[model samples]
Structures are given as structure tokens and as C-alpha cells.
Target: MPPPFPSRAEIEADQLEQLRALVTELFPANAFYTRKLEDCGVTFDVASLADFSRRFPFTTKAELVADQAAHPPFGSNLTYPLAAYTRFHQTSGTTGAPLRWLDTPESWAWLRELWTRVFTAAGVTAADRVCFAFSFGPFLGFWMAFESAQQLGCLCLPTGGMSSAARLRLLLDNGVTTLCCTPTYALRLGEVAREEGLDLGRSRVRRILVAGEPGGSLPAVRARIESLWPDARVRDHHGMTEVGPVTYECPAQPGVLHVMESGHYAEVIAPATGQPVSPGETGELVLTPLGRVASPVLRYRTGDLVRPAAVRAACVCGTHELALAGGILGRTDDMVIVRGVNVHPAAVEEILRAAGGVAEYQVTVTTRGPLAELALAIEPAADAGDATALARKIGGALETALGLRIPVHTVAAGSLPRFELKARRWHRAGK
Candidate 1:
């Protein structure tokens, strides 16, 4: 159950108090934020969340990347001395060069506190074996999940660099009940299980928590994953390397995720105007993690599109937590205009997935003179016959669904690249 707060005003008052303390401490200790905040004439003593958000100046990935380059290795985001920093991780660098993140002992422990809340929300217990199928690299993903599972006293099983078949064997042999991996990797594991003649639905696994991508939120993708492991429940978790675990799906509500307000402030703004959007309206998500002072993000533009709920809206789970009704609508920069029709890759995915007969697909946009050309490389499902026929069927469905006729071609199964983490399905042919 959520903390029984009287009203949204109380949440803001508490958050503002916390934010004031954080800024007051950060402005003097953290060079990166100090310079940014001081240059903007933002005082450490803030009166309200509105004043802070409006005056603090938005941080961007580009600025962070440049700072790391100028500072060498780790940037000056640290609020404490170098000796106080113990844990080191980095962003995935999917957008550009990776941003190195250093966490102090206090901040690392802070991450554990957060993951514990989310882990409990996902219904994880000490007796449940949380087998992480992640690569467990320095990307700040599975490392946090693994360490936090230890804090929870759950058996943290690492399956890094192990084949899907081996992972399946390990999970079954150990009677693992909880599984964590990317949504693409989960589906890939299911594919491998089917090819190896294994039954995952009968396995002891009962809950699947997928992050690093938006697949778990897609209706077709979620349905497929749940069908693969019929006894298991699939839920989506949204987090960032720069920002620790921030939002998670409500177990009672399947499509939306409630923003855990314990240590973060979330807002939605129109992408073009940079103005706050009304409740139920779609806009980009901006977050400010009140803790994580060692490497804080102040009103960082997340680039994720969302439809934020009403301030007093409470999910069916009986928690009056803020929720994004549609987990992540799409990326602000991911929209591609084809023949003057704006198309979001996620919406395209929905159409193709619902059409059926596709195991995997990749999207590529090429520059054709003055306009963008969209092309799809589709891999047919195992049970489907005549790959060309499947592609044609999906193409027709997509044209009808997206209201545009784009090219769709069939690719041989096992030919396209497979992803273990966040899948890079969309790519621009030319820079």
C-alpha cells in the first residue's frame, strides 16, 4: 500500500523540502551541477518545485557526453570526493558515447533501497530465485538488480554469457521462480526453448520482469511472452543508467506503470513548446531524481512520450501513485515521416505483430531525395509456411493500419542479428 498522504499538495511539499536540501548540498560539492545551476541564477534555496524546475535548466545527454570527454573518464557530477566513490557504471551509449557514472557508497546503497521497493512491488520474495539473464556488464543494468537481490536475501543467479539452452536448464534445475531479462531476449529464449523441445510453461518460473526496452508494454509482445510461459506474469520496468529504477508497472494495472514518488519527481511536457501538457495528454517525460546526489539529473529530458494521469488518480492496486497510462508511447526523436505521414516505430510494430506470422523484424529508414523511405526486414515465425506470403499479409495489414504503403521484405530466419539486451531494431541508412 502507498503512504496515506492527504493530498498531492503534501507530496509536493515533502518533495520540495527534500529537493531543497539536495540542491543546497549539491551546488557546493558537485561541479557539473554547480556550474550549470549557478550560471542559470538558480539559488540552492528553492521555494517550490515549480520555481526549481523552471529555473534549474534542463540537463541533456549531449551536455553529459561532452562533460565526460572534457573531464576524462568520469565527469564532475560527483558531490563527494573521489575516494568516497565506490561503484562505477555507465550508460548504454545507444544514443551517443556512453556517460560514465560513479556512485558513492551512500548512493550505491540508495540504489539498493529503490530496487527493493520495485522488487517487492513485482512480488519478489527471499525464497524466490531471481535468475538474471542479463549480460551483467558495466552498463549499470543487471549489476544493480543483482546487488539489490542480494540485499533482499534472494538467491541471485547470474547467467551471463550462457547460451539460452544452458540458461533454461539452469532455471529448471534450480527451480527458479523469477526471471529478469529484456523483452526481446525473453522472446528469443522462448524461441530457443521451442527449438530445443523444452517446455517453459511447465517450468517453475512464475514472474518475468523485463526492462531496457518497451516490448513488455506492447500488447502483442506481452501476449506472446505470457503465452510462451503461460504460468508466468510479464511486467514492464522503466529505468535509466543515469537515473536509477524510477517507474514500474502496477500488478493490478497491466498497461500503465506508477511512478514511485519516494525519490523522484516526474512531469510531462509538450515536445515542441516545452510546456506542461494537461492530464491525459501525451508529452515527453522529464524526471528529477531527488536522491542520487552523487550524480543527480535535474529535470532531465527523458525523450520518452507518455500520457500522465491525473494528480489524484489512484491505480486499481489501491495506490494513489502517479501513473503513465501508456507505459511509453514512443520516443520524441523516433518519429519518422514517410510520404508526409508520421509513423512511430512502436505503432508500426503493433500492426506487424498483430498481423502474426513474424518471429522478428527490423526497421530501416533511408533518405530518398527529400523524404524518408521506410523498409522492413521481417523474419517469419517457425510454424509459418512461405515466408513471402507472410510478408505480403503483414504488408497489407500495415498499409491498412498505418494508412501508408511502405515496403516489407522477408528475411531468412536466423539471418538477422539477435540482441541480448536492448534491441537496435531501427536504424538510419545514412547519417
Candidate 2:
């Protein structure tokens, strides 16, 4: 039998003991951690959390990439020998090189538990039927999600090779009450449904659990999906292949995502200085997996920008843990500078969707001499006319939303690319 999910306080109290034990186990076994601990001159016997954090050096993707380059495949962070590991997966490599991640049986179970919380938060009960529309590849997309649903006693349906039309038919015919996919895929499915004259609102899917991108937290995106499926509930979740599922959105507070501080230690810090930032201030997200000892990442900088909210005592959700406002704002690398104003692509999408005239849009950024310029190619809605007027409206919205003057251009319908996976909406020239 699996252990029940403990409250935030219970988990935190338990974490102190686990942290000390983990330090002892990883310190001497893993060369990377051993060297990191020795450099800070800290021992596993340290009692204070502050002292422990102060001694350990922050981990970065660049460091991990370098280590992988130094040692092919699994890198040098393994506490157990290569034979001890049981599973292998890699990062999506959307931003850079794919990172190969390994897991022992115990660590894999740990991942199942992390996802279990996500399902529970989304109100996925044993009576529900869940369908995972994923490729089921090595990217850890829906493999764990499927397993976690089985563990939760829900009937799991895997739609890996089926086309979107077939998947839609299966979802309706099988009475799947829950869905798991990227936010982009969910919208894409909506588009397909409209073309097929299928009303998704009449389908059996009552809930949507979205990850893999920032679309879940964006209000316009969320609203658009909800508008299409009026009966379904869409919730945002945050996780990584490197770190297990770490944060989940509380249904009561849809705007914020609560970090599973019991399973991981989260820190918000100044990206350049590596120092802790003040509460409620935007900073880089650093995570340390407490349970994933097989391939543990200590203080791994996730390159996600977030503003940490102070723990509120009187909350509908009983967990007294760190919460990120508006979920993940954007990635540090995804920030676009247009006319000296920093803009997140998600923010731009919100403006376009809100304007109610954009069917699809693409943002292209390039260097013209020394200036960074942004050009938006928008596909107006079927009901929209006067493309230039709509373009000006989009430009005005961007200016008001981000305080940036971005040049918007209207393009022919179907001019922009349609994405089935993660949407590459922004392009940079001469990188």
C-alpha cells in the first residue's frame, strides 16, 4: 500500500530527517556531490537548513551539460553504479542539448508519487476514466502519468499512435472523464473538433491537467479552452524530467501554484548574483530533489522565472508552502526585448487572444543593425475585417500590456505554422 499524502507541515518535519540522511548518502557515493560538498567544507551532520544551503553550491544546466560532455550518457552524478539504475529518459532539448536522466526502481516510484499528488489535486478519483494523449516516448511525457493513474485506481487509456480524430472518438466512446496533455495539444484538439463539427463541451472529459508549457497559466489561453469546453476544468501544473512533479495548482486558488516543498526545497534567487531574492520578487527558480537520490540534483537552477508568495496561514488549501504567483511567468531565455522593453511571448499571446481577432500569430525577433526588432504575423479571425486596423489594435494591446512598442503585421490565413507539440511561436534570426 502507498503512503497517504501528508500535509505541508508533516512533510516539512519529515524532510529535515530525510535531508540529513540524503546528505550522508550522496556526499561520499556521488563524486560530483562529494566534490561540491568538499568545496563548501560542509558535512552531512549539519543541523541548520540555512547552514546547509549556504555550504552547497547551486547547480546549473550549463554545469550539467558540461558534466555530460565530460562523461557521455548518464554523467558523473550517479550515487549508484550504472547497473543499479533501471530506467532512462532525456530532456526535450527544446532549449539546448538533451540531458539523459536515469532512475532506479525506488526513484521511479518516487516520481509516481509526485504525479499522484497532481492527479489528486485535479480531483481524479478512482471512479474516473483518464486518457493520456502522449507519444509515450523516452521524454517521460505520459508514461508516469499513466502509471500514476493506475496507482490511483483509475482506468488508464493510452492513445500513443492514434490520430487526433481517432483519439477524439476514443475519448468520447470510452467516457474518459480526465485528460492529460500539453496546453498546445489541448487547443489543437479543440481546433480539430471544430473542423469535424464535434462539440467538445458535450464530451465526457470533465477536467484537463496541462503541463509542458506556460499556456495553462495564461488567463486568455485558459479561458479560450474553457470557452470551447464549458463543462471541463483546466488546471496548470509544473514539473521537469530532471525534477519530478514539484508544483501543482490548487483548484481553490487557480491563479497560484503551490510547490511541494516537502518533496523538494525551492529557492528564488537573483540570477546573476546567486543570492536569495526578497519574497514576492521575481527571480530564477532553483530546486533540490529530496527523494530522487538515484539521480539527485542539488539546488538545480531550472531557468524558470517566478515570484514567490509568502506563505499565508489562512488559506483554503491547508498547505503552508511556497506558492508561485501566476504560475511560471516565463523562462529566462524566452524573454524577448522589443524596443528596449522585455516581453514574454505568453504575454503577447494573451493580448492577441484578448483582442478576439487573431486566429493564429507568430512573433519573429531579429537584429537590424544594433537594434532588436520584433515582427508579428497575425492571422485574423474569420469574422474580422480591415487587417491593418486589427494589427494596430494588437500593437496597442502589446504597448499597454508590456509597455513595449512592437510592430504587428497582418498575414494571410494559414500563413503561420500549426504546432502539434510545443509551439515554436518565436524565431530569432542570425543566432
Candidate 3:
């Protein structure tokens, strides 16, 4: 059985205790955080969460990258000797350079325990068989999730090297009840299933746990995936290799993601001002993982934008944990200015997915012009007829939604790249 949800007061008390313990453990030992905190005039003891937030500086990816470069290999973030760390994984290099993270056995266990909360929220049980449709690379994508699911006594199946068709077969053959993957790959599998005449709607999989992307929370994307697998519930989750598992979608709420306050303390701050945003306002997400002391990050800037809701007087899920209304809205770095308007790739994706008739699409930013322009190359679905007309319709939709005339061109079938992990469809024209 899954663990019961704790009240807001309980969560806050636990956070204070863990934050104090974390600070006590890191001072004078973890070189990276010690220098950072000391330079900011921070002491080993924090009176309150507010005091810690005010005194401690925000840690960024660039700082960590530079530290790793200067120190070589593992950097100075280690709380223990090099030999004390056992697990190794690196970032996906999606934003910039890949960050190498190390974890001791105890810290790794902390990670698995957090993942259990994710599974519990999704209603996954030991009797269910889970299939992870991932590359199983060194990027730390679904490796921890696979292990955590196994620890839950769920029959874990990994389709690391297998093709999409093979993975679909494995899920069906093994009677898998839960499917774990990114929202992008989940759509890819649905596409493949249609191409091969496989009926995924009738499969035994009842839960689709998606992370690494915001599509799972977007209405259009989630609608498309639900249409593909009518019987399964698409659950959105967000995490990072450095920060560990952060938020999971509430089964009771379709689009709301509750921060796993037991695992990490979360704060939303305005990107420009760096001050805490008001409830129901969109801002960047900052996280401080209470556990994982082997390599702790104090108030790490995650770069992902979100809108946080105030604690509910009466909650649907009966948990007072911080809720992000629309999951991850977009990335801070992913915002592009065109014609005096700020646009995110996620916004374009929502428009395209809602427009329909598009199977796969890629965005190319053209910087050679006076103003940066976005050109879209779309691969129409098999059933979408008259590519020329479909392109014009999509172009009008983009203009209507974004108030900018983005050029939409139809690409050959299967010409656009398909992602099995995090999708990098947005590109610069001359890059």
C-alpha cells in the first residue's frame, strides 16, 4: 500500500528539520556550497526557511559547470570522500554542458524513496507491471524510476535498445499495466502503434507516467495522448538529474502538479526581479532538495517557469503541498522575442497540437533577418489530406494564436526526427 499524504503543517516541520540537518552536514565540508554560503555571510544554522532563502545565494548551472571545469571530473560538491559516492550520472546537455552528479548509497536510496511518492500518486501498485520506454543512457532519465518501480515490487521492463515496435510488443506481451516515458516518446509510440496497426487503446497499460517535458500537462498534447490510448491516464511529472524528482500530477486534478514537498522545498520567483511571485502568477522555479546530502544544491535555479497556487482551504486531493497550476509552463531560456512579443516553444506546440493534422513538427529560428523569425516545418499525419491546404490552415492558426505570421511548410513523410527521450525540435536556422 502507498503511504498517506501528510498535512501542510507536517510538511513544513519536516522541511525545516531537513533543511537544518542539510546545512549542518554541508558546512566546512562540501567545498562548493561551503564557499558559496560563506561568501554570502551565511552561517551553519538557519533560524527559518525564510532566513535561509534570504541569506543563501541561488546556484546556477553555469556556476556548477565552471566548478566542474576548474576542479575536473566531480567538482567540489562532494560531502564525503570520492570513494563514498557510488552512483554516477550526467545531465542531458540540453541547456548547456552536461553536469556529472555523484550519489552515495544512502543518497541514492533517498532518490528512490522520493520516486515512490510519484508512483503512489499515480496509483501504481506492486501487482502492476511497468514498462520504461527509454534509451537507458547515462543521462539519468528513467534509470532511477526503473529501480524505484522494481523496489515497489512492480515487474519492471526496460526497452532501452529496442525499437519502438519491439517496445510496443514487449508491453503487450508482458501484460504491462503502467507505461513510463516522456510525453514526446509517448506520442511517438502511439504513432508507431498506428503505423503497425497495433491497437494500443485496448492494451493492458492503464497509467502513462510522463516526465522530462511539459507536453503531458498541456491540454492539447494530453488530449492527443489520451485519444491515442483511451484507457490509460497520462500523468505528468517533472524532475532533473541534479535536483532529483520534484513534482507529480495529482490524479484528482487533471492539469495540476503537486510539488513533492517531502523530498524538496520549492519556491517560485519572478524571473526579472528574483523575488517570490504572488500566488497564481507565473515565475521561475527554485528547488532545494532536503535529502541527497552527498551532493546538495541550496536554492538551485531550475530555469523552468511555473504558476504556483496558494494552499487550498479544502483540497481535492486532500494534500496541502504546493501546487503548480499548469505544471511547467516553459523554460526561462526557451523564451524568444519576435515582433515585440515573447513566445515560448511550448505555446507553439500547444497551438500545433490543437490545430490537428500535424504528425510531427520542427521549429527553426531564422536570425539573419532584422528581427528573429520562426519557420515551422510540419510532417502531416497519414490521414491528413492536401498538404498545401493543411499548411495554410496551420499558418493561420499560428498567426491567430501568436499574432505573428510564422511560415509553415510541409515536410516529406517521416522526414522530421523522432525523439525517444527529451525532444530538441527547436533549432537555429544556420546552426
Candidate 4:
């Protein structure tokens, strides 16, 4: 059985203990954290979470980037010596330069254990044939997931580098009962299955586990994926390379997700001020992955927008771990102010997804003029005709929903590039 989440009181005590231990373990050998903590007048005698938050400075991507640049290859975030480390992984470099992260044998094992719990939360077992449908690379996306699924005693199939059709064939031929991929790739596979005349709805696959994007949490997008595979359920997994698996969509609550409070500490703070938001109010997600001495992120700012879950709400999972209202609303950095009207691409995506005729769409922000402008390009579904009319309708609908006039263009069928990994949905000028 999976490790049950501890209660709030247990989490508070455990987190403080872990925080103290982390400080002791890292401050000795890790120059990066030692300087960071000491500069802020922080010490081992930190009393509460509030004290920890106030005394310790928040870790940002810019600092990590600068640190790595100063120290080539891997940064000096390691508590243990290089000889003590065994694992190597890196970030996707989505925002800027790719951050090269190293882990000690202990920390590597930490990640493996965390992933096992993640898989178990998704209800995977040895009997399930898990097919990894991700494009494997240096990216840490499903690399750990593949390893952890194997740990679950399941038949782990690595379909990396294989074509969509080939992957579909592997899933069907091998009796793959569960799939692990990004939400975009899952939908791409559905499109391929339709094109290849393969009925995915009748396949043996029963669960679709998705990560690396907000699509899984979107009811409209989740519904579309679920519709493609009739009996299959879509589970959303949220985490980052810096932070180990932090949260997973629970089977007990269905759409509601619980954070891995036992493994990591979480806080919801105002994106600009770093102050804790009011209960149930939206804020940026600040994470602290405990026990990762080799590459520990102390009160790291994740830039992910989220809301704190209420206490004693809905069906309790027997473990009263902190729950998230809607998993990852959007990224604080990704939110754009379009002509005085603030907009998140995800908000637009939600509207487009609900509109129903879009097969695939991309949002482009043009900074060519004094005022920032937004445009939408979409490929209409096969059955949907009158592309011009559809685009016009979508444009009008976006105007109504966003309270701003935005231009919408129709792209020819199969013109828009499809993504196998994280979808690059935004195209900006003068970056």
C-alpha cells in the first residue's frame, strides 16, 4: 500500500523537523544554501513555518541559473561531495537555460520512492501493463516515471523515439493497461489512432496518467481525453524537476488533488509580494522538497499559480493532507497583460477548449507594436466546415469572454506542428 499522508499537525511537526535537519545537513558543505540562509540571518533554531518563511529568502530560477553559470557543469548546491552523488538529471529549460541538477545516491533514492508513491496514488499495480508514451531525452519528464513504474512490478514499456502509430501499436499489442504521457501527447495519440483507423476506445488501456501541463486539470480537456478512450480515466500528476513529485490526483476525491506534504512542504503566497494569501485565495506555489540534501530547494518559488484547499472538505482520503482546489491554475510569469486586459493563455485555452470545434490551437502574442496584442490560430476538426465562419465565431466568443477584441485565424488541417512532449503553445515576438 502507498504511504498514507499525515494529518495537518503531523505535517507541521514533521516539516519543522525536516527543515531543521535540511539546514544542518546542507549548510556544512553546500556553499549555495549556506550563503543563502546565513545572509538572511537564518539559523538552526528556526521555530515555526512563519519564522522560516520570514527569515529565509526565497530561491528563484535566476539565482540557480547564475549559480550554475559561475560553477560550470553542476552548481554547488550539493551537501555531499561529488563522489557521493550517483544520479544526473536536468530541467526542460522552458523558461531560460537548462538547469543541470545532480543527486546523491540518497537523493536519487528519494526521487524513486516519491515516484513510487505517485504511481500508487494513480492506482497502478503489478498486473497493469504500463506503456510510457513520452519522447525520452535528457528531460526529466517521464524518465523517473518509467523507473518508478518498473518499481511497481508492472510491465514497463518504453516507447521513446517511436512514432505515434508505432506507440499506439505497442500499447494495443502489449495489452498496455495504463499509459503515461503529457496531456498533449495523449490527445495527439488519439488523433493518430483516428487517422490510422484504430479504435482507442476499445483498447485494453484503462487509465491515462498525464503530467507537465495544466491540460489534465482542465475539465474540458480531461473530458475530451476521457471521451476518446471510453473506459479510461485521466489522472493528473503535478511536479517539477527541482521539486520531487509534489502532488497527485487522488482516486478518492476524483478531480481533487492532495499534495505530498510528508515528502515536501508547500505554501501559497502572493506572486509579487511573497506573502501568504488568505485561506482559499489564489496565489503562487512555493515549494520546499524535504530531505534532498544533494540538491535541496529551500522555500523555492515555483511561479505556478494555485489556491489552498479548504480544511475538512469533501470525501476525506483517510489522510487529511493539504488538498489543492484546481491543480495549477497558470504560471505567474506566463500571464500576459494584453492591451490593459490581463490574460492567461490557459484562460483562453479553457474557453477555446469549451467552444468545441478546435482540433488543435496555438496562442501567439505579438509585441510588434506599443500595445501588446494577442492572436489565436486553430485547426478545425475534420467534420467542422466553414473555417472562416468558425474563426469569426471564436474571435467573437473570445472578445465576449476576455472583454477584449482579439483576432483569430484558421490554420489549414495538419499545418500546425504537433508536440510529443510539452506543447510550445505560445509564440512571442522580441523576446
Candidate 5:
């Protein structure tokens, strides 16, 4: 049987012990960590969280990438021999070159446990049928999610190698009660449902757990998906190939995601200063994997920007930790400045979804002279008015939401690309 999910306090205490043990185990064996820990005068036996925090230096993707390049295949971060690892996976390469990640059997089980929390939080039960809408690949798309369903005793339905229409058929035919996919793909599936004239709202699915993008928490995006699947509830989750599923949405709180600090240590720091920021302040998310021993990361900076809030009010779900206010507002890298105003693609997506005339949209940033401009190409609804009228509505909505004027251009339906994975909605011309 799987271990019962521990409370935040319990997880923290357990992690503290694990941290000390891992430090000792890796210190002499792994040169990368040995140098990192030794430089900070941190020994393997830390007695408190504060002591551990002070001992470990911040880990960055750039450093990991550099190490991988220096030592091909697996980086020098490995504490044990390469033969000890039983599983291999890689990053999505959405940000850069995919960094290969390996895990021992024990660590792989921990990954499943993290995902099990995801399923449980989304109200997944043994009686339910869970369908994964992912192309089985090295990117860790839904491989763990599939394994998690089995761990939870749920019937797993693999949608790999099937078309959207076929997946829809399987979903309806199998009475699937839950779905796991990227937020982009959920919307894409909705689009496919409309094309096939299938009433998705009436489908048997009761819940959807989405990750890989901020669309799950965007009001308009969430609203649109809920509108299409009336009986289904949409929940957001956050994870990375290097870090397992470390945060998930609680049904009690609609849009907020609770970070599982028991199995991980999470911190929000000013992106520029690298200093800890107060609660409710937007900052870069830095994570430490407390349970993933095979390739544990300490203070790894995740480019995701989030505002963390202290858990004061008791939640309906019981487990307590920090919660992200709006579930990954946007990535620090994805933020753009247009006409002296900051814009996140999610902000634009929220406005477009609320306006209701857009079928699809793309935001492009280009430099003309010394000024940066924001231009949008949108596919208007079938019954919507002319392109100019739709454009005006979009511009007004954006202005109201962002306090900035943006140009919206109506484009032919299907002109802009649709995404099944991460949606590259915003393009920055010339790097």
C-alpha cells in the first residue's frame, strides 16, 4: 500500500532528516554537490531548516545545462554510479535543450507518490477511469500520471497513438471520469469536440487536472473549459521533469494551488536580487526536492513567477502549506514589455477569452525603430461581426485589464497555429 499523505509539518520534519542524510551520502561521491556544499561550509548533519537553507547554494538551470554539456549523457551531479539509475527522462526543451533526468527505483516510486497526491486532490478514486491525452515520449508527458492511476487503483486508459476524435470516442465509450493533459490540449480537445459535434458537456468526465501552462488558472480559460464540460471541474497542477509533481489544486480552493512542501522546499525570491520576498509579492520560484534522492536538486530556480501566500485560514482539504494566488501567473522569461507596459501572454489570453468573439489568438512582439509593439492576430467567432469590430472589443478589454492599448487584428480562422503541447502564443522577433 502507498504511504498516507503526510501533513506539511510532518513532511517538513521528514525532509529535514532526508536532507541531512542526502548531504552526507552525496558530499564525497558527487563532485558537483561536494564543491557546492563545501563552499558554504555546510556539513551533512544539519539540525534545522534554517541551517540547511544557509548551507546549500541556489541551483540554476544554466548551471545544470553547463554541467550536462561538460559531462555528456548524465551530469556530474549523480551521487551513485550511472548503473544504479533505473529510469530515464528529459526536460520538455520548451525553455532550452532537454536535460536528461534519471531515477532509481525508490526515487521512481516517490515520483508516483507525488502524482498520487495530484490524483487524490482532484478527487480521483479507484472506481474512476483515467485517460491520459499525451504522446508517450521521453518528456515525461503523462507517463507518471498513467502510473499514478494504477497506484490509485484507477483503470488507466492510454490515449497515445490515437487521434483527438479517437480519444474522444474512447473517453465516451470507457466512461472516463478524469482526464490529465496540458491546459492547451484541453482547449484543443474542446475545439475537436465542437468540430465533431460531440457534446463534451454531457460526457462522463467529472474532473480535469491540467499542467504545463498557466491557462488552467486563467479565469477565461478555466471558464471556457468548464462551459464546454459543464459537469467537469478543472484543476491546475505544477511540476517539472527534474522535479516531480510538487503542487496541486485543492477542490476546496478553486484556482489556488498548494505546494507540497512536505516532499519539497519552496521559496519565492526576487528574480533580480535572489533574496526571499514577502508573501503576496511576485517572485521567481525556487524549489528543493526533499524526496527525489536519485537526482535531488537544492534551491533549483524554476523560471515560473508566482506570488506565495501563507496558509492562515484553514482549508477544506486539511493539508496546509503555502498556496500560489493565481496558479503560475506567467514565466519570468515569457513576460514582455510593450509600449512601456508589462504584458504576460496569460493576461492577454484572459482578455480574449472574456471578450467571447475570439476562436484562437496569437500575440507577436516586434521592434520597429526603438519602440516595441504588441500586435494580436485573432480568429473571431463564427457569428461575430467584422474583423474591425472584434478588434475594437479586444483592444478595449485589454486596455481595461492591462491599462495599455494593444493592436488586435482579426485573422482568418485556422490561420494561427493550434497547439497540443505548450502553446507558444507570444513570439519575440529577433531573439
Candidate 6:
């Protein structure tokens, strides 16, 4: 049997030991880190986590992209031979170019184990029938989740090529107990179910594990999902194709996410200055996976902004893992300055999700004028009568919350794009 959960001190010590082991194993074999560490004049025998953080250089997506370009295809980060790798995936490329990632059997198993912990935290059991509603492409999330659920002896159902309607039928027919999907997709599926006259609240689905987007943590979004499927509880999760599963929502706390300290070492720092933020302050989340030595990223900058829980001891979850108060707030680059007001997509989504009756929406950042401004185009649901009134209500909510008057327009039904994975509703249209 596995050991009990370690305390914070034990977790830190384990992290330090793993850090040393990874460094010892990487140097002289991994060309990427050999050059980086040598250039920084650092050695493997680091004393403490603080020293390691101070001495070790950060790895960024830009650096990884350039490295791949310089070295061609796989890059020089691989410690093992190419033949040993069993998995290949890529980033969503929502911000910039997509990043290709690879994993060997060992590394892949490590990620699967992390997902197991995520499932355990969310109270998923072997008796639960889990259905993954996603396109089983190069994206690593659902693939890991699907495989992990299988390993847990769950009746894993994959709805890859099926349409939204077909997937809903399968879900209801099979009495799927757990649903794994993005929050946006969850809302979309609920909308589709409503249109089809299918009552999901009567279905056996009791838990929803949402990731690949920040919508799960937003109170309005979570409430909206729960309202749509009255019997289901939405649980937020955060991770990346590069870093593996980082955090899972605390079962006791609705909005808080506990870090998976068993496989990750996390830090929150100011995105601009690269300095550590206060306990309760918001900052970019930096991650270092303890396992994944085959394609390791030491002190990798994740670009995700989060606020750490003010008091870890206050948590009723019993584990001492660091908790993120509201999960991931938004990406660092997702913030926009519209007429002197700093607005984030998450904040806008919060208001929009809270103001029900809207089907889908898109935001266009207009830079043709003297300053940047936001224009919202919303697609009203069939039940949302009087498009003009819905638009006015959403506009008032946005104005009250953001302190900026963003123009809201109603577009034709089914005009805006729907997302199955990560939602990309914000568009920059203009030079």
C-alpha cells in the first residue's frame, strides 16, 4: 500500500532530494540543461529549495521554441533515446505557436499517477462511470484522464468523434457518473441538452471535473453549471501539457485547489519582476515536476496567474499542500487594458456567466481608434427572448463590474464559434 500524505516540511525535503537527483541525472546526458546550467555557472549540488530557486535559471516557452527550432523536431531536452518515448502531444497554441512535447513510458506513467491522485481528491471511485467528452487528438489532458480512469477500474467512456448530441445520448443512456470536460464545454453541453429537451438534472452524473480553462473556478460559471445540471457538482482542475497535472480542487472547499505536491514543486512570483509574491498576493505560477526526468523543465515559467491561499492551516482538507484560493485567475497575457481599465477574460466571463440567457459570446479588441476598446457580440439562446434586453442586461453587468462601458451586441444564433477544448473567444482585430 502507498504511504500516508506527507506534511509540508516532508514534501519540501522530498522536493529538494528529487531536485538534486534530477540535476545529477540530467547533466552530461541532457545537452539542453548542460549548456544552460554551465552558462549560469551552477552545479548539481544545490543546498536548499531557496538556493535552487535563486541559482537555477528559468525555462520559458519562447526558449523551448527557439531550442526546438535550433535543434530541429524533438530538441535537446531529452535525456533518453528517442526510441524510448511512448507519448507525443502539443500545446493548444491559444497564445502563440503550439509547443510539441514528448514522454517516455516512465514519464507517462508518472503523469498517470498524478492524475490518479487528482481522481482520488475529487472522490472518484472504480464504481464511477467516467466519460471523457473531447477530441482525442494530440492534446494530453483527456488522454491522461481517460487512461487514468481506466487504470482505476472505472468504466471509461471516450466520446472523441461523436457529436454533442450523440455524446449526450451516450451519457444519459449509460448513466455516466462522472463527466470530464472543460467548463465552457460543460456549459455548451447543458445548452445542447436543454435544446434537445433532455433533462440532465435527472441523469446519474453527479460529478463534473473541468479543466483546460479557468471557468471552473469562477463562482458564476460553477453556479451556472450546477444550475443547469442540478444534481452535478463542478470541480475545477488546472494543469498543462508541459507540466503535467499541477492542482486539483479540494473536495471540502468549493473554489480552492490543492497543489499536487507529491509530483510538483510550485511557486508564485510576480510576472514582471520575477520576485516571489506574498502569501495572499496574486502572481504567475511556476512549476517544477519532480518526475518527468526524460523531458524535464526546471523552474519552468507556466504563465498562469494564481493567488495562493492566505492561510494553509485554515484548510479543512487535512493535507498541507499549498492551496490556490480561486484556482487560476487567468493567464498573465490574457489581461487587456481597455480605456485605462485593466480587464481580464476571466472577469468578463464571470459577469457574462452570472447574467444568464446568453448562448455564446465573443470579444473583439479594437485598436483602430486612439486607444484599445472592447466590443462584445453575443448569441442569444432560443429561450432567451428579446435579444435587445439580454444585451442591455449583460452590458450593464459589464459596466458595473469593470468600470468601463463595453458595447454589447446581439448576433445571429449559432453564429459564434463553439469550443470543445479551450475557448478562444477573445480576438484582436486591427493593426
**Model number with the top lDDT:** 6
TM-score of each: 0.96, 0.94, 0.97, 0.95, 0.94, 0.97
Q: In candidate 6, which residue pairs get closer than 3 Å at backbone N, Cα or C atoms, i.e. clash?
A: none
Tens-digit lDDT string for candidate 1 (336-356): 988888898778877876787
Candidate 3 lDDT over 1-431, as tens digits, reads 65466767788889999999998999788999888878877778989888878877899999999999999999999999999998999998988889999999999999999988899899999999999998888977578899999999998998889999999999988898999998988989999999999988669989899998889899999988988886898999889998999988887898899888898988899988889999888999999999989999988999999998865443588888898998999999998898888989899999999999899999998776556888999999988999999999999999999899989999999999999888999998753
| 1-431 per-residue lDDT for model 5 (tens digits) | 74354665676687788777766677688877887778877666777877766656889888888989988978888878889998889987888888998888888898888889888888889999999999888867478889989988999999888898999989988899998888778877887888898888668999988998888988888888887777988989989987888788967788888887767878788999888888878999988887676788888889889988754344566656778888988888888777778888888888888888777888888876767778888887665778898899888999898888877888887788887678887776753
Q: What is the C-alpha lDDT of each candidate?
A: 0.84, 0.83, 0.90, 0.83, 0.83, 0.90
Candidate 4 segments exceeding 4 Å error = 1-5, 312-315, 368-370
Better of 1 and 5 by TM-score: 1
**Which residue pairs of candidate 5 clash?**
none
How many clashes (backbone N, Cα, C below 3 Å) per candidate? 0, 0, 0, 0, 0, 0
lDDT of 4 by residue, 8-112 (tens): 677789989988888778766888988887787677567887788888888998999899999888887878778887777788888999998887778877888
Q: What is candidate 6's lDDT per residue for 256-369, written digit by digit as tens?
A: 998888888888999999999999999999999989999999989998999998876636877889999899998888898888888989999999988988889999998866
lDDT winner between candidates 2 and 6: 6
TM-score of 5: 0.94
* Model 2, span 163-279: residue lDDT tens: 888888889889899989888788778777877877786798899899888888888888877776768889889899889898889768886888877788888888889999988
In model 1, the worst 10-residue window by lDDT is 2-11
RMSD of model 5, in Å?
Answer: 2.5
List where candidate 3 sits over 4 angstroms from the true fold: 1-5, 311-314, 368-370
Q: Model 2 lDDT vs. the true structure? A: 0.83
Model 3 Cα RMSD, Å? Answer: 1.8
